[model samples]
Target: MKALFIGGTGIISSAITRQLSETDGCELYLLNRGNRNESLPANVKVLQADINDESQVAKLIEDLSFDVVADFIAFRPEQLERDYRLFHGKTKQFIFISSASAYQKPLSDYRVTESTPLANPYWEYSRNKIACEEYLIKQYREQGFPITIVRPSHTYDERSIPLGVHGSKGSWQVARRMLANKPVIIHGDGTSLWTMTHNRDFAKGFIGLMGNIHAIGEAVQITSDETVTWNQIYAAIADALGVKLQAVHVSSEFLAACSKEDYTGGLIGDKANSVVFDNAKLKRLVPDFVASTRFDQGVKQTVAHVLAHPECQTEDPEFDIWCDKVIDALQGAIASVKGR
Candidate 1:
């Protein structure tokens, strides 16, 4: 099988690339901007080109035909349009990486299946993804473009410990707070249920969909069945670091209004709500798909990896100050109400 991955080295797609490279008779080509220094499998080749430059992309893959072409970075319909023009007849399958956050916000149902209606009025990012899906479905219906949509929710790898809030410094900052026993901010009272999938486990279901005919014109969310609360997730991380959990629960609405713009989309619009994914569709399609990594186990590995590496401990003084400000504001509000 000949496969090409556009923007392969990401939180989710990196695992898929690793899997594809090791698969028997699978020839994988990574199309990226030659930036990140990920040690990919030796057999897997690199096709260096900027996907945004239509001419460059065309020239790069002009002579090659692939059995599967999975794009991991395309977020808009225009990019999908470019993909349709480029790989319409060149690839057997074109997989688009969609987001589970694309599902309806303030959802009508907490359980989301592939059939769940795609709508997110609160976030333009999800709205754009919804538009992209619509464009691909149109292409599939009208032009016979073979397309499959795979949605992933809160998927983490060895490099990251997935969390509800990271301030502005990213996951390492939250991990730092945990290590220092400082109160880590958790949005929405820390009770909202969330699903976090290890990228290694996510690879199993996604690789099964490669060159899979049943996946054509279908949308499937590949995630672990394991569900945990934001509080539990934070505790898991804290436990991994051998520290006590110090969590400060804050309102998601307040976080959105006061924090960065990403809070509006990445938090209130998506992670704020509890989501239970019905991965029965993925299971039915790929019987071998299993997400075996428990949060406690995966989180331990992530924390260990970050601690062992000096580069992963990213610092953000501004974000640290922001967190303190938010906590202070919450405390001030409480004191005023109590007449203290």
Candidate 2:
């Protein structure tokens, strides 16, 4: 089977490309921005095209017909609409990489399934994904578009620096700070539960769906069954790095108040809490789909990777600015309380 991967150069997509290349009887093709071709297999055909350009994408798809198209980075509605039209009647299967963020969460609720209502107020990200899923399903019903949607939780590879658990800047920042012997910053009392998945396992689940007729017209949650609190996750990382998990936990109430002030550009509270996903549907489809890397194991791998590659250890500027604003608001709040 000829499998074409769009956005195949990403961390998760790289894993998927490797898996496809290793699988016998399957040939892999990659269509990416062509920025990072080093990790890709030499035998795999590479097509350089800007995904945002419809003409470029359409021209490429017309020439190289694929049995399956795994889109790793279709975030916006325009991107999805264009890609859907380009591959509408041509491809056998259209696999979309969606996110658990598509569903609104009160982590305490736990066990959210594919059918759960998506409560995304800031739909810029989640709404667009949900919209694309809806569009694909519509196509499946009317035009028989073989669409399979996979919603993965916080997927981490050795290279991943996920922001949900490690703060807005991601775990990479924490790893860098730990390397510098600085205290790790914890947002919102360090009590939120995080559901993280290994990128390898996530890639395998994506591959497992290939050409499987049962997976078509269905959405599956690809994630680890276990849930870990933020404090525990940080402690595990600290243990791995042989550093004390000395973190300054910020109060959610303070953050909410800070998000309101102009100086801090308003506070952003944890709208989602203690949330977990039910991947029973996916497990039933791919019975042997088990996450091999535990949270601690994944953390260790990520830390080791960061330690090995100093170049990969850069801070996210946006997150740093946001953190600075929050800290400013926090100091202001402390002063106000003292004055009162």
> TM-score of the candidate numbered 2?
0.87
Judging by TM-score against the true structure, name the best candidate: 1
Q: Give per-residue CA lDDT, model 2, range 1-340, as digits (tens).
A: 8988888877678788888888889988888888899767777888888878888778777767778988898887667778778887778899988878777633335668888876565435676787888887787898888889888877777775554324453456666666667655565677777777888888778888888888999998888887888787778888778887767667655554444222121112122266677888988898888878888988788778877887667676565455566666666878999995
lDDT of 2 at 4: 83
Task: Compute each candidate's TM-score over C-alphas.
Answer: 0.98, 0.87
Worst 10 residues of 1 by lDDT: 160-169
Q: Which runs in model 2 stand beyond 4 Å of their true positions?
A: 106-108, 163-171, 252-272, 316-340
Per-residue lDDT for 1-340 in model 1, tens only?
A: 8999998888898888888877899988999887873688888799888898989999888899999999999999999999988898999899999999999888889999988888888889999999999999999999889999999898999886788887666788888877888888999888898999999999999999998989998999999999899989988889999999988999988988887748889987899999999999999999988899998999899999989987888877778878899999999999999999
The candidate that wins on lDDT is 1
